[model samples]
Target: MTANPTRLGAIRTIEASEAPAAFFDVTEKTGAIFGENVFSLSVMQKRLPKSVFRSVYATIQRGEKLDPAVADIVASAMKDWAMERGVTHYAHVFYPLTGLTAEKHDSFMEPVGDGTAVWEFSGKTLVQGEPDASSFPNGGIRATFEARGYTGWDVQSPAYILENPNGNTLCIPTIFVSMTGEALDHKTPLLRSEAAMSEQAQRVLALFGHEDIDKVVSYCGPEQEYFLVDSAFVNSRPDLLNAGRSLFGAKPPKGQEFDDHYFGAIPERVLGFMHDTERALFRLGVPAKTRHNEVAPGQFEIAPVFERANLASDHQQLLMSTFRSIAKQHGFECLFHEKPFAGVNGSGKHVNFSFGNGNQGNFLSPGDNPHDNAQFLVFCAAIIRAVHLYGGLLRLSIASAGNDHRLGANEAPPAIISIFLGDQLQDVFEQIAGGGATSSKQKGVLSVGVDTLPDLTKDAGDRNRTSPMAFTGNRFEFRAAGSNQTVAASMVIINTIMAEALDFLATEIETSVKGGTEFNAAVQAVLAKVVEQHGAVVFNGNGYSEEWHVEAEKRGLKNLRTTVDALPEYQSPEARKLFTTYGVFSEAELESRFEIGLEQYVMTINVEANLTGEIAKTTILPAAVRYQTELATNVSALKAAGVDADTADLLRVSEMIAALRAGIGALDDAKATGHDHEGLAEAAYYRDSVLPAMLQIREAADEIETFIADDLWPLPTYQEMLFIR
Candidate 1:
């Protein structure tokens, strides 16, 4: 009935705030500043001696291990380049199990004698840096007392300079590992999986009559979606500040219902923020290419051009951090949490994936005549087989507490992992399954009604947004991955499973050819067998429908709905064998990951539960009581005047107040009672008990919000947060 002062103040703050000025000077062209801060191949070529540069370039281009002999030369060149740009320190940037970037900064200035100092970056320092392993989540890989962790230089991922107002730092992307050589970070496993996949991909290429092939690399172009709310609103709401999401907010009346926001005109304020982010990303060579409005109010997306998987993962981390910082300068808080607001379309990071080498193009691309493109069909068949055998692994890859709120919610992909081959490719695969494919579908032209308008070329197949993994032209867009998660984990699963499938197909085709069968016929036979066995995983229908759920179950698909359900797949025998055989993860490494995932899941729920209870008691409950007292006082006064008054409003408010108190108590009890179990059991306890308790608290709190006077509300409402901007 009344406008809350906090909400009104937030609106004023946002209205008064102006977009930041141009980040770059007019003299500096966008193309010129791009990759200027990076120690790229060109920079290396210009800095190092020809011989030394060649060796370093080999490592960067071909994924070869950096030679020890060339480390000193490379380090010297890097240090010189950094110092020229006023960089006093260098940090070994790594991705830990916490799903955030970690760094240990060391000053390059070393004291000489007599108060003199010289900038020094040694080969050993460049190659390795020590950070406390125990401080990071290592599962059981390292004991709490054992604090030794090493960050090793990944030469393939170029080093870049991070700018600051005071001074800059030269940041080298590295992989974190324990003293015993166990992977303690996301990057190590991703790099390992890439290597495994590349080896098998080359073998498949060779079988297709390619003589000399370049090192295959999996490429990723992740489309990131997020919500941007004014910092004033975020700062006022403790839940948003602490939990990165609104713990309890009633559904707004106008929340993405009309589909008007999707691909709508960009808001000027958001455009300025985007420009600032793009400039920063460009300097770091992130290749941020596309920007647009997303489905929900205040939600937006940015997609980078394709890059090598390792570099893309590193860039993705940089992009999130960049968005956060730049957003603040522009008076916004970028919310990367999936389902930051309920009853609205959530955010997702759709990773468009494809693998290829210099010698041949994308292995998944079925050319104009896909029906006769035996090599393409073989590669496509490989994916079908991979998804069929390891669909559970794919589902587990994207599993998280935040993602659980989004999956199968109509906005994001369902938990049941399946490939969506559009009609053209589906027909080709069906032909193969039946016997052999003879004809290919051709694209049709669309003629506009206006004489001035030229005819448009139409794609052979339509796109499917509902599918978890859809074939979008040459690449598969993994729409199931959460916007907040690191792209490395899902990529690791994709690369490793693809490697297994490629290895199997290569062996089968090679064996058949060696036994005096025609090469094309052998390929056809292998592909046919794959289709017959694995075609069930390819579903082009709406993945969101209930019929698909029943059909998926009938097809033997495992619908692991929650993180607790999906996480155990990490310990499965099939997972162990796939990782171990491919040399991506050792037995210990795999088990440690399982432990870490479960721990994270439980910890996430615990934090949310505590926040819910704390906010309800300290903020919402007090406000509700004040409003209830007001209603009771009014009712008593009206009755004392001898005039009839309705007690319905007063009674309703009183009932809600009681419910809120009870819910908060139950939530606190649930939070306090869930510590006895550990790992998966603990995670299950949180999911079954703590989460339900939290929802109960949220329900009561939300209902109280509707009854309470708006001026008496202590927190910003969802309508204000999502739409005010």
Candidate 2:
């Protein structure tokens, strides 16, 4: 750790062989080992009797009740399979209200006669476990001394094996609840939401002459974007370690401005990390599909194939955890902060979602003649109506302190939740609303005016990256989510709201048909009504533009720009009513979540502010002043020697030092006021006032870094961190 200015620069361009080998171990029998590490459907089929397997499948597929008798047999089989995989312990993995995964491990060993040990896992153990609830954030749901909480097995999501340096263990996906049976985690509400949506969606299908369709599940494929910085750099930067973002680093002379990093070749070290992560994910039955360089330096993205929302969310958590663990082995740090760097593009989780039957038919798939596919149009209208009516909930679903820096920034989607129906769908909606006949259009060919990309057949609509919620060919990509978030929150909101919309549509259609209106005419009337009422949510313009904000206001779209501003919507009367009526969340549960969210917002900013202040005072200020003193001494020595002492740059550096001191004082004053965390109003005040002061200090310090001799600079720079493989 010698103070060499070029040490980081020298290592930045290391040869490919210098990096670790890609993790392709052909000796491991990948195909055979795939899902060998998971207690998946195949494992269940082999372990359980035919009757038990059928019962479990029914529960997973049709949302039917699990048979009490079958639970023991299923758990016994899962336990045996896990033991064969060298798993001595089991954990109920859950997602808490804090928006991160939580787990508590217990050994499978049970005491036998004569002090002998027997490895056993019982149905009771697999089905439920009690953990202390008071230790976790409950938003006043539980008292401090109330230590009772239950974790129930979520049979819908398959259990997976988690391997660590110490050992391997079985990880069962579970839903956490309070002792009094109140939802205490993100998963329980999500599962409830899924069930609610299925009930309503079945009604819609029944109206369409598909009475046998028992369940309709929403599916999601979230494209996760993240940054990987060298471990040494991350450890050296206190801001990043504490806040998961750079609080003071200046933008490198060369940032993403050249646009050379986007879709660039994957660096060898990063490729090794990705390989290892994908291998682990694949073993866990996660269908990880795409991996490639993203828009910023040291940034990459991975997308999985679509699956049911619950399973997808479970896999997403596993994927993120696996990435971090694998990165540690590769001597790197994976950063999921929405904006890890100031000048580079921030990370986002683009959630591609669609509804489908168990038979794998996507309901959103508009056939060649989208206008003629009335079912597709109806489903699409359901989403539009849901989004329009409950845009606040959708916005609140992705709200967080980390995301506050990314959303509404030029690179990411704006905070205003609007749908991008694309040109073709927009036209179809207009025609349907205007009571005009639908027209069919053939696919068009795309030409790049070059031979690189073959003339490929293109879909009817162009992709709009700027829109918050864009409808791709078959699914809507909800791009508002931060890279670090679990997919459960967004999925729950989408599923629940869509369920409410569909239920309304079904009721209206049933009334119309019962009143002697023809089926087609009634369907058309409902579509027209939906377009007239909720079409304002469909916006295809550039969401990043200021003009669009004004236009959105005219369109009556709610713009919730920050976590503090957006989180209150969770407790709104309309939102509470929507969730309660749909059986997604009780009013009490919704209120609890609102408090938890607001508290999280305040705590996140408070921690960041404190860390920024500490770093500036203890590390950055001393280094800058020491460098300034050296420059001043050199100027005086030159003057004494009767040389043409040119101190212009040195004087400029001195002025910057003064400005840095002033900025630090401002931070001190802001901290002393202690106005932050008073409530929502004060929390917003901190974001608007104190947070800006902290940034100002960072700006002055960053300016000083550029001027200081590289040897004297104490902290790692963006160039050092970003360019490193």
Leading candidate by TM-score = 1
Give candidate 2's whole-model lDDT.
Answer: 0.86
Question: In candidate 2, what are the lDDT values of residues 1-725, reduced to their tens digit?
Answer: 32645444434433222555655574676577677688877778877888889999999888889888787788788888888878889999988887778999999898988999988788888899987789888888899999999999989998888876577889999999998888989898888898888888888888888756858898999999999987777877888888899998888878888888888888877887887887888788889899999989899999999999999998888889888888877878899999999988999999999998865389999888888888888899999999999999999999998898999888889999999998898999999889954685567998979978799898777899999889999899999999989889999999999999999999999999999999999999999999999999999988889999999999999999888889889878898789889888887788888778877877788788898888888887888788878888988999899897788877888888888888889888887775634667777777777888888888888998888877778788888789865
Work out the TM-score per prediction.
0.99, 0.96
List lDDT for all candidates, in order.
0.91, 0.86
Candidate 1: stretches off by over 4 Å: none
